[model samples]
Target: MRVLAAMSGGVDSAVAAARAHAAGHDVTGVHLALARNPQTFRTGARGCCTLEDSRDARRAADVIGIPFYVWDMAEQFKADVVDDFVAEYAAGRTPNPCLRCNEKIKFEAVLDRAVALGFDAVVTGHHARLGADGLLRRSVDEGKDQSYVLAVLTREQLDRAVFPLGDSTKARVREEAAERGLAVADKPDSHDICFISDGDTQGFLQRQLGDAPGDIVDGRTGERLGSHNGAYGFTVGQRKGLDLRVPAADGRPRYVLSITPVTNTVTVGPREDLEVGVVTASKVIWHGESTSVECDVQLRAHGEVYPATVTIEGDTLTARLTSPARGVAAGQAIVAYQRSADGDIVLGSATITASAPLATARA
Candidate 1:
């Protein structure tokens, strides 16, 4: 089988590419140059788009004895993932860029190009399982499972995807890389937003969307509490850094309840106001069965799962949580799964459009 291995200059991707070669598949490694100018992005282990990362990927491919090439995906990545991320936030919603990257850039664009070039599959180091039954499942290493981000993929897109490091833990993969003479074996894992190397997301958004001064209002009293540089800086359930002038009458911390981008107003209230019992989403994609099922829905990446009753109709999906989920935000994905004796099977996923409080949901 001919495979295209995506080498991200990280230990996981390098090891995944090497393992593919060891499996005797005719493998060619390709590094995506996501940053138009590498100098603008962070260097070292902090970012995947740096010049250092591309060189590391090339070195790994050379050691693995596979043909290597770098694909210039900066324009596509910017238009699809980066621009969309800024737009989502500007629209007063929290978006997961990783999921967008997987759906639009990696699986869609890269996979399409691979198949056109006669490659059988595009393999990556994603920590998620693609079962023999063609269903996506959680990795055995739960701590590193990335199924939530990858869940946005369509069934057909998932068919051409290959995850070589799904069953292996990060520790084991690092050990294997060391044995294979891979230099990135001991490299620290990338954290935070890859594009925002300094880890200042608020600063990053300010740079992208610019400052749109807004009012922070108390949700209960409808009184203005403070002023913010931008409403895009806040998300649902953000507590710290509010800088409100007035203290709450109850003397409790106030969390951001919602953001209205058009009005440029951010509403803050008690933490209990963040709880939601119903999550309604759009642009649903089903990988396995498409029936209305009693399942578990994961709202955020690496977040806790909630038992839900999921009903799918057309392109819409609605999940009613058995227990209220705090901080349910719009534009994030709600991935549904079925807990089976075999494993937690990914049923489908959708982009959250709105969430209803327990009382409103029941009514």
Candidate 2:
């Protein structure tokens, strides 16, 4: 089979491409230049699209004896991931750019192009697995599992995608790279979003959404506590940088409860106020033909998965969490997983449109 490996100039991708080559599949390496100015983004020790990263990818490809090329996806990335990120914030919703990238750019755009160029599949270093029935499964390395971000992929994309490092831990991947003499074997992981450098999400949103001054209110009492430069700069569960002088009388730390874009109000309350038991998921994409079932729902990356009963109505999914979860945010993806007769499979994912307190609490 012909494979096009998406190399991010990192150890994981390097090892993925090498394994593909050794498997006797005709392999080509492709690096995506997602940022126009790589140096502008701090990229920290772990980020893709740095000049050094591209150079490292090229060197690794040369060592692995595969044809390598860089594809400039900056414009597309800006339109899809970056622009959507700004728009979500403007609407007072927290957006995950990595999920957007996987949904729109990597799986849809890049995979489409690769198929058009006659590649059988597009391989990546993502820590997720695809079974023989084309079901997506959690990576064997639980700590490095990335199946959450990939829950948006359709059945077609999963059919033509390859994850060579799905069954291997990060440590084993590095060992494989070293055994193969890959130069990026010891490259540190990228930590932040590839496009944002200073880890200043507020600054990035402010620059894009402009200053929309608003009042921060207490969620319980509806009392105005302070003023904020922009509602877009705040997210649910955020506790710091509130810049409020008033302290809670209860002595519990306050957390952001909600952001109302219409009123430009950020609501704050005790951390317990963040707990939620019901979520309405919008723009849902189901991988399997089944429309309704019980599954494990993940609210955030590395978050504990909880049991949930899901009901799909068109593009909307209503999930009732078996137990309450804290810090559930609007605009985040709620990915569903199921344990079938075969194994664990990703059912689908939906954007969290709304969350409400359980009926018992509300009553």
Candidate 3:
């Protein structure tokens, strides 16, 4: 089988490509140049897709003895991941850029191109298992599992995907990379948003959306408590940096209950108001047959998983969590999983549109 390995200039991907080559698959390494201005992305260990990262990926591919190439995906990435991210935040919602990247850039664009180039599959270092039964499952190394972001994939996409590091832990992968003489073995893992060169998300959003001064209203009292530079700077359940003029009568720290971009209003209230029992999602991507079932619902990447009663109708998905989940913001994904003897299998995923309290949803 011919495989196109996505070398992200990281230890995990380097080891994954090496393992694919060792398995006797004709392997080619491709580094995606995702930034139009490479200088705008992070320079050191905090981000990927920089010019430094591309050079590192090429060197790793050299060590792995595979044909290498770089694909310029800056325009597509800006449209799909970066632009979508800013738009979602501007609309008063939180978006997971990693999930969007996997859905649009990696799996869709890269996989399509690989297949067109006569490659059998595209291999990556994502820590998620794809079983013989064609089910996507959690990695054995739970700490590094990435199934939440990968749940957006369809059955056909999974068919043409390969994850060589799913069965191995991060430590083991780094060890293997070092053993293989890959220089990125000790390189620090990328952190924060990859495109945010300074790691200051609020500052970055301010630069993009500009300052839209708004009022921060006390949700419980309907009284204006303070002013904010922009409503896009806050997400649901954010506590610090509110800079409110009035303190709560109860002396409790106020949390952002909601963001209304249309009115440019930030609603603040007690933390209990953030608890949500039912999540309503749209644009669902279910790979299963059942319209309704009991499963685990993960609201965010690397976040908590809750037992939920999930139902699908048309393009909508409703998840009623057995217990309340806190800080579930709109535009994040709700990924469903079914437990099995092998592992937790990804059932599907959807973008959350709203969340309500248990009583409110029941009513």
Tell me, by lDDT, which candidate is best.
3
Superior by lDDT: candidate 2 or candidate 3: 3
Question: Model 1: runs farther than 4 Å from truth?
Answer: 39-43
Q: Candidate 3 lDDT (Cα, whole model)?
A: 0.93
Compute each candidate's TM-score over C-alphas: 0.98, 0.96, 0.98
Rank order by lDDT, top first? Answer: 3, 1, 2
Q: What are the Cα lDDT values of the candidates?
A: 0.91, 0.88, 0.93
The 10-residue segment with the lowest total lDDT in model 1: 38-47
Q: Order of all candidates by TM-score, from best down to worst?
A: 3, 1, 2
Error of 3 at 355 (Å): 0.7
Q: Worst 10-residue stretch by lDDT in candidate 3?
A: 38-47
**Predicted candidate 2 versus true structure: per-residue lDDT over 155-229, tens digit per residue:** 888889999998889999999899999988888898777777777888988888888999998988888889999
lDDT of 1: 0.91
Cα lDDT tens digits, model 3, 1-363, are: 999999988888889899999999999999999989966544576777898888899999999899999999999999999999999999999999999999999999999999999999999989999999888999999989999999999889999999988889999998888899999999999889998977899999999999999999988789999999999999988999999999899899999999999999999999999988999999899977798999999998889999999999989999998999999999999999999999899999999999998678667
